[model samples]
Target: MLVEFRPHARLRGKQPADLGASVLPVVAAVSASDTDLGKVRVVCDWVQYRNNFRDVVQLRPILNGDLEIAVDVRRAADAPVGELTSALLRQSPDRVYLEDWRPGRDSCVWRFNALYWSALDLWEKATGRGYEQALPGGESDARNRAAAAELIGELFAVWDRLAASAALPDELYVIELGVGNGGQAKVFLDEFRDLDRHRGTAYYSRLRYLMCDYSAHVLDLARETVAEHTERVSSFVLDATRPRTSLGFLRYKAFLVYISNVYDNLPTDEVAQLGGRTYCVHNRACLPGEEAAELAESVSATVDELPALVHKLLRLGPVLLAEACPDHFADTDAAVRFWQDTWAALRLAERYVPLAGLDTYPLTDTLTGEALRPLLESGADVRMHVSNGAVASFVDTLGLLHPFGKLVCHDIFVDDIQGYRTTFRGPGKYDGSVVNWVNGPLLAHVGRKRGFDVDYAPFRHRAGGHVVTMTAQVRD
Candidate 1:
């Protein structure tokens, strides 16, 4: 059977006027008997669902936690939440609508690591257009294209000051991370060339514009796109989270580090405050081959195996595939294709497990766990971005800048934690990648800790966009 439910009347469309009260009978009936199946279906953009109940089932919107409720089904009023959840999940393949939680450890959203390491190439390969075409406002331009232009205007102001002061090196450097299609790089280089010519500053001749990204394929394309500025342009394939490793040669030398919509794409873990307690959100990833486009149940993973499998695939995708089939090692591209398909079909089941404290938060392995404690604030119930990757990336990039240098970035940012609790911030899909609202306030707080001034303001040239320009520099 299929059912439709709403959390509230005014939220979006229509459900029953008394939907919440009306669905109690249906839920209680299913919980009492095993023959009747009680499944959950999330009616949100992040997930898609199909069953006979679409027009048949009547559900009241029991919108509580993402993976916490099974139409509020429980054995009794006092049944424990974890036990109830485990029991509900064991009831065959029932539909469970989850908002922000996940099922277990190591079950990441998958879209992000997949994109950065492999699917990024698939983005242009699968589609003739570049990945940027997936931008909401359409075409290769970001919906915030106006803001990109605004970013350039501000860059010039910073540059003019640096040039006049003469404290910066003669080899003035402007490094842009995540240079999509080299459009911004092209525009920036072209503008700098002209600006130098007009001002007779000779800045263009001495300019070293370095473009960095995770995808070598994108870098090659960007190289071709900006061929006109070959003399002053160079490109490096580097990880955004650890900029200083490849960037060591230019340490404390680059005058400006520019980024656009890059931080939001980096990996992040979501933490939530609920009923005066905190929990780490996790997801159990799967491939139900029977599902519309996903893999089948035969290939579905066990709880422990899920993380191990994802890790093995990330570390030795081709080797593992070949070990399973020795004859196909010669056809490397075919293995790549299978991996791409798997990533595309990947789906996550959410679960929110309670946590002990900040000391045990997961990002600690890759980032300073203690540094992130402040971001997990306690107040009126809310959720916030842990932006571990962004903070790690930002801190490393800051160290690479010269004394007169600064870091300029533009992306969807929540200037306050309340924005996350009240607004529709996301881990939404963009092409084959994930786009999140990087925690701006958290980044600023960390910046101040390192003796730097980090400030956020609406992109000056635009009016109505979530994009904010973040500027970070050593305190004057």
Candidate 2:
């Protein structure tokens, strides 16, 4: 078996080579070439590696058929080396195999994520609640009327100046991306109309409010919520990562593009710098062998058939999946239950593979891995999300802004390089979608390169909240 050791941010003042030598004996028993375990990876700091989410000693059936043993450096430093062997033996498996390995960007996790939104209505009915109820506070901060009013005030300030020069366009535009249940759009429109009436301005009469989201089901719900302003609102089903494809007509015309709780859900890849070498993290989705057996039996199927069934569920959704595989699923409810169960049982196996060069890494379509060296090599050892989808959307959306226009987003952001070292940034499950904190400093860097000023501040409306407000505008 091939042994790879990755020391994380929590591992301080220790060399990767030293850590590898200390744990060599602990992994020797499972390293036989003929053994069922395909590869071995020893992680020095499991807590920091997994962001303190799971409390476990080892993760089996990881990428490329690897067995991962996680060690607590502090404890291992003091205890007898044999204790590490004991923990490893306790979690060692009888046999290990999985369908395939993939990068985090190519994992089945995203398919499941899209399924959640496409079949959201059915999921809500089966679960007896909406997706928003699964959030921390059972609601999004984006719906705040006060926050809407604040943004509207800023738009008014810009419009007032433009109006003075007789340059205000005949039609005023305000675009909202990721219109979750239309709550934010309703609040903004209501505030705009009220504020416009109060100020005795005709801006409301010239307003064109556009709501965009990836889910048609979500857009339908949003339309109902904001039915009072139907004349001013228009909704589109568009991919958040490539908004320019759908809204190219509005290039350099949109005065405001607002987003909330959206960027964190986009797909991202992580890169790590270890022992003076850079590597890209690749992931494979797996269920523990025993758990796989139990789940398969629960669905009236064998463990060998789980992967194909899962792919079917993701491609056809639970309702059609029930019809497609009547042998495994009695009906839609059964398939929905299977989907939920598999998601809860889902675990990712990750490996660090050496990169040929940083330049070869594509951070996004317009940016490359060369941009990440500054952040990756800033400290001892670190792993950080590249936020590929968010960066692509940010760059494309910038094209939608007028010279004086602004883009505002509120989401989880890692504002400082130190934040990655100290906190769990995510890859956490939020409902059925994925959430990873966007790289704020990197985005600010890219925006500056494109002649725009980007700034990040804590969400002002909610004190001590995790949300950060990022605003970008053409640099004066």
Candidate 3:
């Protein structure tokens, strides 16, 4: 879809003029080729001034192929062109997916986006692929299903805590920033039903959850799933970084936000701007061998040029900051060496001098509480706990453990008590399996590093699989 904004020539000025006497003209256009695409054009009709108001006119065309709008303005001739341009640009029309389209004024754009992404995720899962394989370790349905169950359990637990605190709003509207699918929402709904029964009131009506995602296909699946539960759940298609343009209502309404499994895809500044009482989750994987090799090579080459390249780019400075090396893989030193060697090989082929003395961590141990304690102690809040789950043996064992696990209790902590069963499809095979990376190492690291109380529970589904859910709270 294409969108553009243009302001009429009449509203440019240096000194403030009476906006009430001025009329501003604006134009917006959007185009789309997809049959399922839905678009909305919002044109602010009036620019409110300190003393009075200005009428902003809007023109809409009827044909569905493309949208072109024009507005007439009669404003002060000395008005700032930048200000005028900014106002018009803010209202640009864009093609939005059907999942993100809200028919009335009461639309939840964020929810629609979440649902849209979730639907696409489901399709990817159903199809056994994704746009890109960014993480190491092959994808598996068992892993995704187990992860979904764990995520749902976490959401329910959070809701319970909020409810118990008695500080929750009478009407809770939750917007999960990166809700991949309705899996977590489903868990929330189930928990809400139980909470309703316990509280002896229709708590469901007071609660609304929305999922926002970037993909329309995913939102469709999320919408379908949410519809099966209750109308309170909805989906929206949105880009997280530019949510304001799509989810203007969020600025006026208060909501508890959840961002999970999506932070790695965003930059730090963008993450900081996502305001709200938010629960954020991030997962990082070890880089694949090839990518790691490339990284090491680049670093080595920079070092060889020495004082110039390293000092200019790699050194810590006001204008430039060195990029942190990816914290994946078993041997940090070996990974660095691979890069250095690759660089040396390149230099030798070109008959250039080699550079040495690049320091690298030789430790083979997996990242532990001790290693990460410095980061935690540096006064950085632990937004979310980190975990790794690529161990083949642990994954295989989880499949075995799933069959016997009983769904004992599920609230803040999903507890399933049962014995182990063997369901591992073997190496390279994708099946739903849960392992120690989630339950053991991750829980341990968070608990020890952040001095947080942690709880681990096993959930057994009648369908036969074990999923472990863990919760942690940082120390006061």
Candidate 4:
């Protein structure tokens, strides 16, 4: 049951007669309890909307009414005079309205229909559980556990691919942008512990995990999550859409940045600043043009080059791991065509080189043509590229061997039609990309321009889907 409120009778000035006729009756109907004149308590919260300047009021009655009343009001924390005049004109005669709402006020009405909450509700409806229930924890859930294991395995796999001639950094700062319940974080931490046992304590101690989010409520939840790890993790509250303030950049310098389900929230410039090694995951849902329009108004910039923003982020760091819903692209051929066209339109054909010699590269048996051919053959379509990672070593090698080379390695993966369907089920969907050398012969032409030695490990993998990871070293 949802209740709506409008301060303005029409669009401009309040129509007192109309309010008395239509608005008051609606409020009275919703607020009326078991008794004819039952009282309803209104909770006022200080949070205000940009367009409207009215205090949010929530009505709770002792007895259920025929209609449940929920009023959403907007007010400015700091507004000039007459801001609440229109809102005040629409007040119910018999109902008590809470005034001057602020944070920590129990009377403030909470925003219940936020996007995060909506997504949670949708997930709950799909999974047959309360939205508040914790997702698959570190143990017992085989599918989630396997996904975690695969992600951890990819970290090293990516390292091997990029570290061929370089050494691992002394410290790896990993920041997960949208860590919902820290389920994946826990799995990664567990894997790191295992690696410590096998490699050395020093290797483990040098690794730090930071989970960032926009909501203070979510940040509070993460505090408990980090507490479970006990000194192994920490959390921060941040708006990723905002620019990297001096303080933010100081806090976020790291070997890798891991963002899950956050790309849709950021503008291209913000994404570009998130350079350094980064791994991002997002669904295929296209951002509504209106939403983007609003963002542009606030940020004062149009999002004309979303793909370029992606490319910039990939190049900022040597290795990047990004995932999106395959629904964004229509099919494998469509996916290829999309990139081909995207690069052509951007006049950046020379900057991106698809990995062609996939067979010669050390690929897992599961990643073979027998496993991937069907998706290509069946015409699997996608809304966005899923499971993307960039090898910085490849980037560096291209830069060194071909000074003028601006090639970026990409691995394209399709999961629905693949034999290893287990990998696609845990997460929303699966698509893969890798650095293909056969498709990138222009490398020699570009490599001759510059030559320099870079120390990084060569990435090696037994299979394609095993791990989507990349690693690179930055020298002082």
lDDT of 1 by residue, 1-476 (tens): 33333234333455223333334444444456452343443221111121101112212222343333333211222334334334544553333221244522233554335544454665455456667766654432222445554555565677778667865466878898987778888877776677668867777788899999887877887899899999999999998989888998998887789888789878777776655567666655554434322322223433334334444446665446547644433343554554555555555554556767766665534554455555555366565667767888998888998776789888878988766654545555565666678988888987898888999987776556567888998899
Worst window of 10 by summed lDDT in candidate 3 = 418-427
Which structure is stronger by lDDT: 1 or 4?
Answer: 1
Instruction: Report how far off residue 383 is in candidate 3 (Å).
Output: 25
Tens-digit lDDT string for candidate 2 (227-289): 999998898999899999999999999999999988988888888776677878887777767
Candidate 3 wrong stretches, greater than 4 Å: 1-168, 173-184, 190-199, 212-215, 228-231, 234-444, 447-451, 462-466, 474-476
TM-score of structure candidate 3: 0.30
Q: Residue 303 deviation, candidate 3, in Å?
A: 33
Q: Write the per-residue lDDT of candidate 3 for residues 333-379, one digit (tens) a residue.
A: 43333322322222100001111211221111233223323322333
Better of 1 and 2 by lDDT: 2
Q: Against the true structure, what is each candidate's TM-score?
A: 0.73, 0.86, 0.30, 0.30
Q: Which digits, one per residue and each the tens of the lDDT, describe model 4 over residues 1-476?
A: 23222334332465222323333443454444333333332222222212221223322221223212323323222332122323333453222222232111111111111223323433334446543343222121211455455555655665554446565555555556556656656766777678767754444576667766655555655566557565657677655433132114423244344443333222210000011111111112122344434433332335553434323322321112122323333333333333322222221000111223334322221222222222223332211121111121232223221111112111222212322111111111101111111111111212222332222112232232222222223322
User: By descending lDDT, how would the candidates be arranged?
Assistant: 2, 1, 3, 4
Best by lDDT: 2
RMSD of 1: 7.8
lDDT of 4 at 285: 16
